[model samples]
Target: MAFTGIPFAALDFYEDLEADNSKVWWNAHKDVYDRSVKAPMAALAAVLEPEFGQAKLFRPYRDVRFSKDKTPYKAHQGAFVARGPSLGYYVQIDPAGLFVAGGFYGATTEGIARFREAVDTEVRGTELEGIVAAMQEAGFDIGGDQLKTKPRGYEADHPRIDLLRHKTLTVSRHFGSPPWLETPDAAVQVRDAWRNMAPLVEWAEQVLQ
Candidate 1:
């Protein structure tokens, strides 16, 4: 279903948030995740009108516990909100730092190597690095202070190429938007701030892709 300015209950806001480590949560609330976050993103993609396939969502669980720094899930919720023939825009929902953007990254270790190579070799030398550097200048940190390049050990020739995960500010609350979400730039405005977030209903739809 699409968001038509309907006022959902506050419980709806926390459904996905509360879906931590429980199959029950995943089974019961996966639909909620679709509804609350992915749906609105799809709507935005429609409005922005990308020239490629529909948007899609990555899985939440990352098994990094064996590594030095372990995270239960990614801090940012995202989708391929819009796409051009060559590149795509990822509309990320970071409520703790609620914002959105378009980009690429690898979800696995081998994929991460290509991702790292791309970022270090491709992005850092191009306009994307400027955007990443700008976000850093604005106070957001990458992954964490420890892992700078990208996580390694992903499968080679993976589907997700040049995928780099982003981190929300550590200081922000677990569920609130960051202060910088209101930057005057339209893309930054929609991509970074929660007050003017694209409707969750639409985001829910995009992620289902």
Candidate 2:
């Protein structure tokens, strides 16, 4: 399907789902979820596939076996284009708005060790810091899994100690119900953010793998 934009009903669907997360509610509103939410999400991912690769849509069912909250449905829908086993670019939609990001969601102990090693070096470390700065300048918020204290060997005095604290590095931003979200320009917005964050994703792919 050609990309148009996310419909307003998509937002409404999520808004109601947040209140009643039961199967009864879902069955009654199943058509809205399929037509308004899932279709646009698929369309949005489709247009970006040429440059970003195919996106995998997350199943709406929540995995409650390991979680405390037993909510049956997800409040948001997300799609991801992976570059490595655990690193990739992403987009999500919900009642609040659109969220776009790129980076490793999780890292193995060995992968994090390698990331710290890269951050300890002057050339690669500073290069990463520069890319992070540029991403912030372009309006994306930086976040992801992080350590509470300095890693075992890295000193508090280390110049890039902050960067070294990250176990999973990512940049994202929420664009809340913007007007463009209802038009084709929404795809362009996602493209621009993904393109801008390519360096960080590339850096993680190299260091983590």
State the lDDT at 1 in candidate 2: 80
lDDT of the candidates, in the order given: 0.40, 0.93
Error of 1 at 176 (Å): 4.9
Clashes of each: 37, 0
Regions of model 1 farther than 4 Å from truth: 1-20, 51-53, 59-76, 81-87, 94-97, 102-188, 191-209
- Per-residue CA lDDT of model 1 for 51-92, tens digit only, reads 434666655666685876453555445656432221244555
What is the alpha-carbon lDDT of model 2 when measured against the actual structure? 0.93
* lDDT value, residue 61 of candidate 1: 65
What lDDT is reached at residue 109 by model 1? 41
Where model 2 places Cα greater than 4 Å from the true spot, the runs are none
Best by TM-score: 2
